[model samples]
Target: MTATPVLVLLDHAADGTLRPPVRELLTLARELAGDAGVQGVWAGDEDVAAAVPALAAQGVTTVHRLATDTDVHLSAVLADGLEAALAASGAALVLLVSSFENKEAAARLAVRTGAGVVTDVDGLEVQAGRVVAHKTVLAGTWTTRCAVSAPTAVVTVKANSVVAQDAAAPSSPQVVDLPVEVRASSTRVRLVERTELAGSGRPDLGSAHVVVVGGRGTEGDFSAVEELADVLGGAVGATRVATDEGWIGHDAQIGQTGVTVSPRLYVGAGVSGAVHHRGGMQASGTIVAVNSDPDAPIFEIADFGVVGDLFAVLPQAAAELRRLQG
Candidate 1:
């Protein structure tokens, strides 16, 4: 019996290097493919050859590369090339990282291939020649198992669900040039301007294993919280009230109205733990709360609770961590 190949839709940086999420996707793909082989396809305007080393290190043996214009929207064209590769490779399953761009592209590919699409897949396994996906739904209230019975299944996996491991021995992946046809719709949307966010030298909130978050109790001073996060090598997040008061950037807000996170460890300082905020981070592996109020709402869900001023607790915690590291 011949095993069908598993296809990976690659995402690369402007420098043509594979992004961390893409690396994580390839790692999961390798596991799901089992005895089956793994192949990849990337279509963009960057230097495709630059991504070869990282792909090879991740055990992707064959790659389909296509070059397109950077200024024009290439999702439509990318989907076309990807579907063609899927047909050519006889792939039964396609894996994509659940990013905004990939989500849109996966939807387009699903329509073209007539394949059942599943998004927010955090885990996957193959049983009896079927793919089972694990998804977090209903604002982290439920864990749902889904299976795509279609001949070809398209799945979008969330970032940071799995740790990426490098292949013991790297292979020089065979690169193939793919035929690209830029339809009128593909070029209709054009990028007019580009703005880059300043780097914070911390992992992305969506993927960080540890997160240190602040709330109204922060009193508009996040210095201690930021230092603690830096010491832990994690990202800093804030509650909606903290952002509303202009203490932290809205991008760092974590609540029903902001971004959702499910890190391995969540540290809440001076947080009252409103249901809205808990909705975003309640799925974390372990939660710790530091608040002055003994009856704070956050203490109800916290695995560990400390009743003390955050300004006093955070600095001491940071100092202790630094001493231990030293």
Candidate 2:
């Protein structure tokens, strides 16, 4: 008997390609499925059949294409389409990337299917005929394990929490067109317009290999840090204090209350490494802290440390990096 497939909801980029986070989810689904099959869902108005090959390369056995013109509201339509897919496929487990839209959709799906919902799950597996999720709790202080007792399990994995690896042997996935009719919801929320933020030409903060973060010690001047990030082809990050002081955009803030990032290299300048700030970046592969005070809390976690003023050190470091690149 064929094992029940794990349904994965994949997000697409503007060019109709699957996003990196979606690829990560595919990886997680593949692992969780194990002996079971892995299935994918691409929900949008765009023709994303081109993504099937990539999904197949990631171990997806089947792909369900749903055309939903979610220009009005995406979550409602996606939830409705996913519900239909679950009913048709009889999939017991649904995996999604922990993006804003996907999380909302997962909640709606749980409500409709009466499935147990788990969010921000970084670890998932099948244990003793049940789906178990491992999630960080209390601001990354502890890890809690929870099992999905319902018939269907809806879980969202944090972006970049899992690495995407190629399947040992690639197979072409059978693509199925799922007919879905989306209607406007009674909810007053409507998408009037979408203003895309101007591109910064830097890597996404969450997925960047290197991140240069500024703190209160920078005295609000991020030019040096920005220069270093630009030289390293990385993203710019900021502490909560710096963002609260309006020295940087809130989107760039990294902390317990802000977004979490897991970069390969993290460079913190003038940061004292408060628990909130450390919570966001402690997972980085290598940490380099630069602070005037050698006793700064950031030094405790830093793989390398420099006791100096950022203004004096950052420019010198940027120049050296530029010269090395040149």
Candidate 3:
């Protein structure tokens, strides 16, 4: 009997590249069921020809390509692809990186395919010859193990939450073209005007080597934090309270309920370091805390820490960094 396929829904960036999470997803699938084959599904405007080996680096054996129409919202389109692919692939599992868009598509796919949908999955293991997926819930304070008894299951994982295992490089990835079909009634919202958030000037949060984050304590003066981030060539993040107070937009929040990040280094300033705050950041390679209180919980997770006011510490750090560069 042939082994069932474990397919990853690979999201293509504007640059026609596969993001890191898809690689991680392949790693997870390989570990969860070793004999099973790993594969990728993508819909993009640019050709995905160059991205095959990048997937092979993580154990992908095949790539399924569908032409993308930039005018349509991807989530709605993704649901259509997911329904068709899963129907034909003899797949036991369909994996997605648990972004907001992925979650939206997963919900629609689950209803359409009658498959169980699990979100925020961080680990996968086989127990009793069945896959058990691990997920964090309730602001990362609780853990749960979920198993799908159906013929198919859809699991969406938090970014960087799962550890990626290395796979022996496969032979050249097999690329197969797919003819995507869409129904008019299936489409809900039409794409109109799209706008990019301009001039935050921060580095890309997903792959940044360094990160600096502020919180409610920033009190609308993020200039110092921004300066420090600039010197370090890092990205800027904020707490939920910071975004709520209007100092930063909703995009900067990092926590269980927001974006998860795992940078090489992370710096937290004036953040109280709630569990929700730690949920998104505990995976960082190194951490530093800048707070006036010695007992702040963030200090507990820090590789280096200073008990000083961020208003004073940030500017001083930025100034010294700038001066040294000059």
**Best candidate, TM-score:** 1
Question: Candidate 1 deviates by what RMSD?
Answer: 2.5
lDDT of 1 by residue, 1-326 (tens): 13788899887767787767788888888877766668998766677788888888988888877644433235676676777788777888888877666778788888887888899788988777778899887667789999888778889987777889877667688888766666667666667766645657888776688899999989999999899999998899999999999998888988766777778889999999998999888878899999999989999889999999999999999999999999
C-alpha lDDT of residue 175 in model 3: 81
Per-candidate total of colliding backbone pairs: 0, 0, 0
User: What shift in Å separates residue 63 of candidate 2 from its native position after superposition?
Assistant: 2.4
TM match of model 2 to true structure: 0.86
Error of 2 at 250 (Å): 3.0
lDDT of 3 by residue, 179-200 (tens): 6687565566765666755546
lDDT of 1 at 196: 48
Candidate 2: list runs displaced more than 4 Å. Answer: 181-188, 244-246, 315-326
Each candidate structure's TM-score, on Cα atoms with residue i matched to residue i, is: 0.89, 0.86, 0.80
lDDT score, residue 208, model 2? 77
Of the two candidates 2 and 3, the one with more favorable lDDT, higher being better, is: 2
Per-residue accuracy of model 2 over 247-324 as CA lDDT, tens digit each = 988989998678787677899999999999988877676899999998899998899899999999989999998898
Write down the lDDT that model 2 would get.
0.82
